[model samples]
Target chain A: MLAMSASDESARSPGVLIVDDDAGIRENIADLLSTEDYRVYSAADADEALHVLEAEDIDLLVTDFQMPGRNGVELIEAARKANHLVPAILMTAYLYVYEQLDADRRKDITLLRKPFDADEILREIAARLGDGNAPKR
Target chain B: MTIPPAAGPKAPPSAGADSKPPGNRRTLFGATILIWAVTAGLGILFSVFAVAIGLQAATFDVMRWLLALAIEAPLAAGIIALIWYSRNMHSATAAGEAGAQALAHSEAKYRELIASAPDGIFVLDPQAKVIDVNGAGEELFGLSRAEIVGHSFMEFVPPERLESARSYLADRLKGLRATELYEATFAAADLKPLHVQLRSQVVRPSDAEPYVVYIVRDVTAQREALRNLVETERWASMGRLASFVAHEINTPLTNISLLTASISRRVSDPEIQERLKKIAAQGRIAANITGELLKFARPGAISPIETELTDLIRAAVEQTDAFRKPGVELRDETGTRSVVCTVDPMRIQEVFVNLLKNAYEATPRGRVRIRLQDLGSLVAVSISDTGSGIPPEIQSRLFEAFFTTKKKGEGTGLGLAISRNFVASHGGDITLTSEPGKGSTFTVVLPKQAPGVRATE
Candidate 1:
């Protein structure tokens, strides 16, 4: 699943995992991605999100920073420990918390401030995935 | 020697023994002289009779003469001793009278000192009764000296503070504590509460009983100022918390906004699209409010560069000229000289723009004037408008966040507050002067070089 050929990439839809404690935000983001020809999985928290990561081959992980029990940063760390080196996007309303992360760790993750335009997040996802069939206008 | 005559009735009371009546001295002198004369006369007569009766020879006998001489000498010595004793008694009386006069003078001096003191000085007897109170003490209690004296000090203390005040006095009198400073609330003549600071000590006079002396000062104003300071600090912290809450709400607002836009793009029905547009606009309004709150809460960083202040002010005036109402005129009075200074250009420009816009908005048909000046170590920009000025009560709260005189949907009330924060971050300040019927002027002053920024010139 990690090494798909050009022909397979065009045939199979890219999978995205959306995690947030807020059901409204999580479902809205899932609805947007599904409309863009992407297969989306949703979770309410880090534990549920990790289970989905283990069960399905997710191409991208999008999560919120502040949550119940585990935060977005820790989930990203746990995913790497599970040998899932998927590209990640960390969404936060708190700029100070994002700034507090280790520089090297932050370099690998794309940060999206909340209340951002839909076009902004889509642009970041497409750039990170780097596929010709990525979501377009 | 005879005793001297007494001084007359008009003589000073401190005249010592000399102040006695003249009639008494004359009587005493007369009696002394009479006793000596009578004794001498009797002796002579007795001697003559003895001779006549021939008890002895008519010629003098040496032994008899010697006995007569011895008797006369003793009488003379006794009279001299009486005069000496009277003189010494008079001297002692004089010294005692002088000492009493000196004591009276000293007591009068101390009375004057206490009367003139600024702090309320109270002299209390052992029973805590007010034996004496100064002029200031009278003024403090709003009562005359007659009303304040002869009253228990506890009578002036409010019920809530009476017990504590009693304990403090008791501790001082009993030597149980050495703390002389205390604070208490006292009731004035009209029962108004007075916050006072008292310094009291036990005064032990050798010639009198031990008593308490208190130096009291009114501290109500100081306490009120301190309370206001604490309240201001509390509001400042609340502002920070409010900004944090605004940040948290932004995420959901983003979801609402983006989701609505997404749906609007996919829908083909004109009616649904129009409704969706309204919802998006409302969401944007909420977003704008939170954005302004964040700006006032955290001003972030400033980038300083060497720039001419005259140019900066001109640009701000031009940007805000659009806000001028019909018939209102704007004039730029800045001269040609370049007043170069190290400052955050964007932040400082915003400050000027905010002031200029406020000036233009205030003057409906009057003139707005903007001027720039270069002081040696500082620079100033003044914006004046010929408009109905702010009332004094509202002027104090003008810079407060969310405080506005503008109508609903016309202002967010964060413009001046954020502008002040920006200027303060650059080590500057804004000042205002206004007259009710005349006009208002706002002045922004900044140092030649921003704090922590190296001089570029």
Candidate 2:
């Protein structure tokens, strides 16, 4: 299942790295992904998320937008600058966060509201990562 | 009838007279006049005899008076009768003046009581003209006595009830002294329609013409309060029904999602399989959301149990570790006494988690302290943060439902409100104290064994 080309790896199944300040949410999301047989990893905040990104092969990021320090948006920008071709899903309780984001950056990302349902998070993740389960747009 | 403690015998003399022999004043006046007449007659007869003897020898004046009266007893008796008549007339005139003074005092007292009674009192003549009204009556009608007295009672009563009221008054005057009960709308002096309960009783003084006395009582506030109670009950019933519906939907929806996922996992067609999986996932999510909504609709169901205070705090902190700021220290300052309380542990932890989360978010670089202590029968727990405290403007409404300072996407305003409800249900109280720049502290106090031991939650 290993790919030799960088683009092939980037285009592979999404590697979701959950960065939330709530352990229950992180655990629930991880548990949800595990039940679906998707490889999932969890971090408490942006710093831990970055550490995981550096050490592991990641294709997608799902991080909360209001965590301490550089939040989900900052993480995505940093990851992109580091030659990481990953699409991210930004989770926040604030709807205005999406409005504030640049239009170009928003195209590659989706926003999830807190207290979110497991199904919505998974569907959004699949759509953003171009999973074969989602209709191609 | 036995008098009340307030009307005991030791009450003032004036108060006693009202309850004692009612006609004693007239008897005492008659006795005083008779005594004054007899004493004046003796002095006048002696003066007349001395004047007759004055023409004789001055030395014989006193002796002559005695001897002359003894010799002409019949003439002396006539002279004595004349003196007695003059003295009796003078005493009678003085008694008349005293009686008049007494009458004036009693009249003044009667006037004072009628003027000062708290109940709205009104007097109506046989023809239904307002005779007299107290200040309370004036206020009830929003008019001065001068304005309402000449006006017929019908002017105040609702039109439909006016004729009936007139008949009632007529009947009261015919010795059928019964109280009439009627709820009618009256026009206030300001022309506002005031709902009132009017009771007309026939007041008949023995010598005076009978008048129909009306007692008007306003019941608007009481009626409005009852209406509000009924409205509140209706909303509560609706909330209960909505919760039941949500619970019903959540159960079956959960089952459907479970079945769908099983079917999708067994499918062989990859494209169809993926779509089915997504559907199952979305279905599960919908079910969870329904469950959350149901939780909000229904009141908490768990019965409180005696639980350790420190244990609850630790559980909440552990549950919310993901939300805590990195590098932020958590410190517990619990006294040696293991503070225990009867409460729904899960719900109490939820409250703690919310407060801790808010505190964690408020602080940037300092420690968050959680302290617990037992103060007699009550246990207190405080969570303090060293971050930027809550602003003063938001503190007043911090626990109000749907009030939140966090940006719209950041927090639901329901957390603190729900937390307050949970704390209150335990027979406990919660308070928040904050300094705009220094930080904030939230304190919760609960009884050792939940609040209502004899009642069910």
Candidate 3:
């Protein structure tokens, strides 16, 4: 009897699933996106995130690189095989290692570093959501 | 007191164009005989003329007068000629003897120089075989003079280094190559390894054949001492790098704490409020790691206080009279801003004073510059002097406790040692670069982030 009318009529409310090992980070992201009126979901790790992706539709995947097992890139690939074309935005503390990823994946996925200002990641999310004309910086 | 020049002694016969030594005796004999015959003939002619004139002449004995003139006149001339020849021969012998004595004294002194030297000295022929060795050489190789002389110099070189040693020597013998110095390992008579510093020279004496002089100093202890010093400096440099890494991480940690706390203030949702608190806690955890790294880089001793680095340097420059004098410029090139750092102000000011005084003393009229700049992650404060630099031999020992080049009563030698301790306590390092006659630069590289800010009023 939890709210199921979320995806029924609101085409404007895009669903996003944030995944990280730190529950606090995932909660903060979900809370921030929820305030923006997007339908936000979160998971503690990749395993749990995959479960959420299979059950419900999510428009975007925001995942952290370092995790206990099955890091962000692997989780994204696994979700893609399940017929989920969830465009991803990767978050990492290490940019150098991230740059060495497959060229196609690097070109498609958006990268975000931690300790960014509140406006920065929000703008990236808005831009990916097809909200036209947000400052890239 | 003017001593009178004595009346001349008997003059020796001049060995000029006329007075040849070989002809002197024969020519004098010829002249005596000729003069005697002419005088005797004249005396007889006079006596006969008197008897012929039929005058009653006084008693005139021609035979007696002729005999007396022949005996006395030629004998006097012969004695003078003999005396002149002997005197010239005596002077020639004395001069030759004196010259020989001086040459012997010089040669003895040279031999003594080699014999008494602390290092091995070898004289080698053009073939690179040893022609001679001094007493030290014999002791160094554990060989007698006979065994070492005439042996190939390469024989004493350690087997591992023989080829390179041979090539180094070969380069020197290729003409006009008189001086070359190198380090090599040599094997003693007992096959023990001996580290040596060798210098070669090709000397050409006018009357003697040319030879190479190989001066070898057994430098095993010196090399070990130098290695220990290098190792110590390397560890110190690594410590400095670690502090820089800690500082770079620290800047981001600050952003994390500030941003997360700011987010917490704007948000009121209960679930998110819990999350924001966790983020702030996690930032503190990250900061703790940086703190541990900083403590590892520099041990905790003195409590550091926040102070503007430029102000400290300026105050130090003003305190020392030498820095205030005319014609000498003490420039604070750290720019116009206050770059804040956590340090012991009094201790740091003392460090600045020491560095400034050193620079001023070294430079009589040129520039003594102090520069503070951010080197990406680290803050560097440097004092440079356009002065006669510390020689390389002394540079390594500049930070050693009680090591000073200043005169007695002018320095206690503890200034640099204490300064290094204070800087090290604050996760910083002091380093020196000196080129003799050019100048010296003393730089202190420090971290911008303290372990945790305790900026006191």
Best by TM-score: 1
The alpha-carbon deviation from the true structure for residue A125 of candidate 3, after best TM-score superposition, in angstroms, is 2.1
In candidate 2 chain A, where is summed lDDT lowest over 10 consecutive residues? A1-10
| Cα distance off (Å), candidate 2, residue A29 | 20
TM-score for all models, in order of appearance: 0.55, 0.41, 0.33
Per-residue error for A1 in candidate 1, Å, reads 15
Q: What are the RMSD figures for all models against the true structure?
A: 12.3, 20.6, 21.7
Distance from true location, Cα of A38 in model 3, Å: 1.8
How well is each residue in B1-457 modelled by candidate 3, as lDDT tens digits? Answer: 0000000111111112233433544655566556656655655564555455434553546544544554654565455545654665566456546655654464466567668989888877667788778888999899998898878887787778878877776677666454655888778888877788888766654444556678888998898899999977875775578567765675466456646755775779989989987887777666655544454455334456788888988888788864544667877798987688877676678788878888887887778899999775578999998889999999999986557898875565656765776677566789999999888999988776655523211
Candidate 1 structure quality by residue, lDDT tens digits, A11-99: 36667788889888887777666557666788888898889899876788888888999999999988888998898899875554565
How does candidate 2 score on lDDT?
0.68
Where model 2 places Cα greater than 4 Å from the true spot, the runs are: A1-137, B1-238, B241-245, B248-293, B300-302, B335-337, B391-393, B452-457
- Across all candidates, the chain A TM-score values are 0.86, 0.81, 0.84
lDDT of 1 at B244: 84
Decide which is better by lDDT, 2 or 3.
Answer: 3
Candidate 1 A-chain TM-score: 0.86
Give the Å shift of residue B418 in candidate 1: 3.1
Candidate 3 backbone clash number: 0
Best candidate according to lDDT: 1
